[model samples]
Structures are given as structure tokens and as C-alpha cells.
Target: MMRTTTNSEITKGIVLKAMPYKENDQLVTIYTYEFGKLTIRARGSRKLTSKNAPSLLSITQGEYEITLHNGLSTLIRGTAIDYYQNIKKTIEAEIIANYLLEYFYRYEEENKPSLEHYQFLAGILEALDIGYDYRIIYAYINCFIMKENGVELMMDGCVVCGNHHVDAFSLESGGFVCHEHMHLNDLRLPKEQLQAIRYLYKCPIERLNELHLADIGPIQKIFEYYVDEFCGVNLRSRKFVKSIL
Candidate 1:
């Protein structure tokens, strides 16, 4: 048997992050539509004259040529498709976009292709670039992440009594609770806000442009608490977004 270093392939992907490897090299993590997540090494990408540098930035979508090896793949070359310059130019959108990129980077498994995840990432980036409300996008993605992890919040009726009228979101019950069943500390959620959250979870990412919620803070907090309690992972980027809001 012989080992080969020329197992090369081409794929379309978005750069999640890039870290300096050697003095003039980089290790780039990319989530591809075809191959899921890949870490490719780019030699001399740190130099100002490097052609591969522009296509390697975070959130840049491009077509890449990679020489796959057993340990780490090497980047042969790439061409940029979308820079998402609109997202990079706006600070708030940039933060939320980074948060999204970090979220996927942390949760998405390597070499496991998920068209759903890839499409969701690509759609959200496009929506953000188009100047949709970042808060609504964040709220929507929170529900998405929670649902994908099997910790989806029960939004239809009270998790306790099945009552149509719900008041507060009870972390203990993992869903809405009527006034009779709500704990002393449960946060009271208004009917409109409750409906909004339900809509967010069910709404397609592409249709987000047609909807808007003036205040997403309350709903966002509910999903955040749900994720923290059930998922057991807290993202630091979430806190950064919270601080500025």
C-alpha cells in the first residue's frame, strides 16, 4: 500500500476563521456546501502580496481547490464569490454575522455535510447583507439552534396544563406556562411577544424580509435562557451582542 498526497478536490465554501500557522502561513477553517467543514493550510498567506489572502477572510464565500491529505489539506488556490461587503461595513451587522459564524464554527461537525445548515448560514448572511433587522435575525437563529439541538421551546400552548392562554416562560417546564402554573420567578411574556416567537421559529429564513419585530429583546432572552439551560453552552459572542444592545 502507498499513501498519496494528491487527493485533490474543488468545493464552494465560506471561511469561518483563519489563524496564523507559521510566520507566513495560515490555517483556515471553512464550511463547504459539499464537504461540510475543512481546515486547509495556506502557505505564505500572511504576506501583503499573497493572492490567497483576500479569499481567506472570515465570511468570504469562494470556490477553492484543495489537495487533501490525511492530516491537513493544503489550499492550492481560490476565487472569491461574495465578500458580503455590506456586512463588513456595518458594525452591528458585523457583530451578529461574526456571532453566527462563531456559532456554526463551534457547533458544526467536521466532514459531516448538512445542506440545511449550509443553506441557513448562507441565507442569513444574505439577509443581513440586505439590511434586515439583526435582532430579528438573531432571535430567529436562536430558535433554530435550539430546535436543531432538540431543545426546542414549546410555543403552542402551556407545557403544564395545555391551556391556550399562556403568561410566562418557565425554564423548569421548558415551555410556556399559564398564570396558574408559572413559578414566582418566571418571566411574564405578553401574548403578542409569544406569537412573535412562535412565528420566528416557524418562519422560513428567506421570508424574514417580509417581517419585522420592533422589540426582539424579550423573545431573544427567552430563547437564550432556554438554550443555556438545555444546551449547556454559552457563546461569548452572544454577550458582546447583548452589551451593545
Candidate 2:
């Protein structure tokens, strides 16, 4: 008996990263709109004359035609759609763009299809290319990922008492705390900052221009810490991003 494999199909996605593989090949991880994350082997992509080499670069969004197999998929060819060159031209945008790619590469499961995740990532990358504030975009990404992973901090009301009048944010408690329920040492943020976080969770990336935070540092730090503490994964690129900021 012989096994039958899936036929070749085209997927549109951004190349999260490509690792050099055995002599002249590369293993490319792509987050696709139809098939979620996929690791495809690109034979001869490392060579200078390889036509697929340009399309396989990190952060390049394109259509990839691949033939699926039981073990691993092979990339037949790719056509570049957008290079997002503007992001590569700026240092801050570039670092944040890499961080965004790293986030999806770390969290998204391979072969699980999710249109929502795909669109969200695409929008973020587009925003970076258009010169949006990287700090705010980074914070937004952190907020969205935490919520998707079921570790989102509550901002609507008190996590403990359900009081609408909250005075502080508690990392341990996992959300805002009402003054009545607040611990003595609970971190206090201005009321505006609290509102900013609430908006961060619900607002789409395209509407990011409307959101203004006088100082995004504190809230951004909170989201980063929340992810580190609750999600239980240390992003390797996070330190470099932080240093440059």
C-alpha cells in the first residue's frame, strides 16, 4: 500500500524566520492566514543564485506554494508580495518588528489555522512599516497576546470585589483593585493610564492613532511583566529591544 499526501496549495503569510539548514537549504517558519504557522524546508535557498532566497527572508510577506507531507513540507516556490522596507530602514521599527515576529513564532502552534491571528499580525507589521510608535504597538501586541493566552489583566473593574472605582493595578491579583480592596502596596496608576489600558485591550491596531498616552513606558512595562510572569516564557529578543528603548 502507498500513502497519499496533500496536493500543493498556496498560503499567504510572513516569514517569521529562516534558519540555515544542511548545506544549501533553509528551514523557514511562516505564519500563514490559512494554516497558522508552518515550517517548510527550502532546498538551495541559501545559495546566491536561488530565486526563492529573497522571498524567504525574515519579515517578508508573500504567497508560498508548498506540497504537504506527513513529516515536513517542501517549498516549491514563492512570490514576494511586500518587503516592508520602511521598517528595515529604521532601527527602532526594525527591532520592534523582529520582536513581533518572535512573539508569534514563540506562541502560535504549528498547523493550527487561525484567520484572526493572521490578520492581527499582518496589521501590526503594516503599522510598523507605516511608522507607528513602536512602544505603543509593542504594548498593544503584549496586551493582545496575554488576552489570547487567558492571562489578561482585568481593567473593567476590580478583580476581587467587582467595584468599578479601582485605584491600583495588582499583578498578583491579576487586575485593577478598588481602593476598598486594594493592598497597601498595590501599584497605583493614574486614572487615565487605566483607561488607556482598557482601550489597548479592545482597540484594533488600525485605530492606534487615536490612542495617546503621555508616558507609555509604565503601562508597557506592566504588560511585558504580566506576560513574563503569567505566560511563563522569556522572549530572547526582549532584552535587546529593551536596551535600545
Candidate 3:
């Protein structure tokens, strides 16, 4: 049998991170919408005269022309379509965004991964681009955890008692519960806030802010604990993010 090269066109992607290599070469990890996340090294992108330096630093919702040869992909040319101007200036957003990027880079399979997760990376970038709410970012992370892992969280009723229009929540049991089930290790989730989380999980970008969260700390902590301790996603960046704030 003989070997042949395969080439294809990909939709668009964001540069998650880039590292300098050799004298004037660089390696970049990109989270793409159509193809999930993958790494493509630029031949000569480390020097001042190189064109890719700007693109490497230009992450967050940036779209580009990714050329794939055989089983390898390279950034032939790229342009920053959505720069996410203030994502860096805002420390909290930057930390959370970078943490999300780290998760994508660390967990996503190079060749095969869920494409929706890739789209999520772009969506989060867009969300951060528009505003600087850390709570919103946290909500997105929780929703991402559920969506990516194929875990369905039923928020309508208690896992133990089948209560509807519930007011409290339990991470252990999944979601909302009635007063009789308060001893089931579920946290007290207010109705309005549970509605906000529900909205976050299902609503589109335009309607995310409709449910104004007075305080997302408790909810965020609950999901974070569940994600890190129970679900086994221990991101060092998450630790760092916690240490700072």
C-alpha cells in the first residue's frame, strides 16, 4: 500500500496557548469550533520578523485559516476576528477564562473530541468579551461540566422525593429538593437563583443575563466542589484562581 496526504478546510478556532520553540519556531494549541481542540506548530514564529507572533498572542474568539497536511495541522494564516478586548484587563475574567482554556487544552483529545465543547470555548470568549461578570463565567463552567461529561442534572424534582417547583438543591442528589429532604446533603438553593442556573444551562447568549444573580458565590462553590472533588477535574489553575481571590 502507498501513503497519501489529506488536506481539508476547517471553520475557525482560538489559540489557547503558545510556547516558543527552537530559535524562531513556536508550538500553539488551538481550540477549534468544527474540530474541537488540537495543536499545530508554526515553523518560524518566534522571531521579531515573524508574522505568527501576533496571531499566537491574539487568542479568544479569533478565527483563522488552519491548513492540515496528512494528520498534522498548521496555521497557514490567521486573523483576530474577536479579540475579547478587556478579558486581560479584568483579572477575574482573565483568570477564569485562562482556566477554561487550560481545561480545554489539558483534557481535549487532539484528534477526536466533542465539537460542541469547541463551540463552547468560542461562546465563553464571546461572553467574556461583552462583559466582566465572574459569576456568569462560573455559571458557564458548571453548565460546561454537565454538557461535556454527558451528565444530565434533573433540576425539576428531588431524586429522593419527586418534589416539583423545588427551592433547595443538592449536588450529591443532582438538583432541587423539598424541605423534607433537607438532610440529604443538598444545599439550600433559592427559587430565583435556581431559575437563574436553569436559565444559564438552557438559555442562549442573549438571555443569559435575564436572571440577575445577586450572589453566585454559593452556587459556584457548590459546582466547583462537585466538579473538582467528585467529578475528578482537578485543575491546578483552579487552585491558583482560588488562591488569588
Residue pairs with colliding backbones in model 2 are none
Best by lDDT: 2
For model 3, residues 1-245, the per-residue Cα lDDT tens digits are 11223554545778888887777777788877666666777777777877656667745565666776445577766666666777877777788888888877887777565556766777777777778466677666767775666666776577677877576777777776778777656677667777776676677765665657777777777667657655657677787677544
RMSD of each: 2.7, 2.6, 3.1
State residue 62's C-alpha deviation in candidate 3, in Å: 3.5
Model 3 scores a C-alpha lDDT of 0.70
Between candidates 1 and 2, the lDDT winner: 2
Ranking by TM-score: 2, 1, 3
Flag the better candidate by TM-score, 1 or 3: 1
Can you write out model 1's per-residue Cα lDDT over 92-192, one digit (the tens) per residue? Answer: 89889888898888888877788898899999899999999888888878887788788866878899889988888877777788889888988787677
**Per-residue alpha-carbon lDDT of model 2 for 1-245, expressed as tens digits?**
11226778887989999999999999999997777888889999999999999999887999999887656789999989999999999888889888889988987888887888888888988999998888888898888878887785677899998999888888788888998888976889899888887888888788997887778887887898878877775688898789866
Residue 176, model 1: lDDT of 82
- The CA lDDT of each predicted structure is 0.84, 0.85, 0.70
Q: Model 3, poorest ten-residue lDDT window? A: 1-10
TM-score, each model?
0.91, 0.92, 0.86
Query: Which scores higher on TM-score, 2 or 3?
Result: 2
TM-score of model 1 relative to the true fold? 0.91
**Alpha carbon lDDT at 52, candidate 1:** 88
Ranking by lDDT: 2, 1, 3
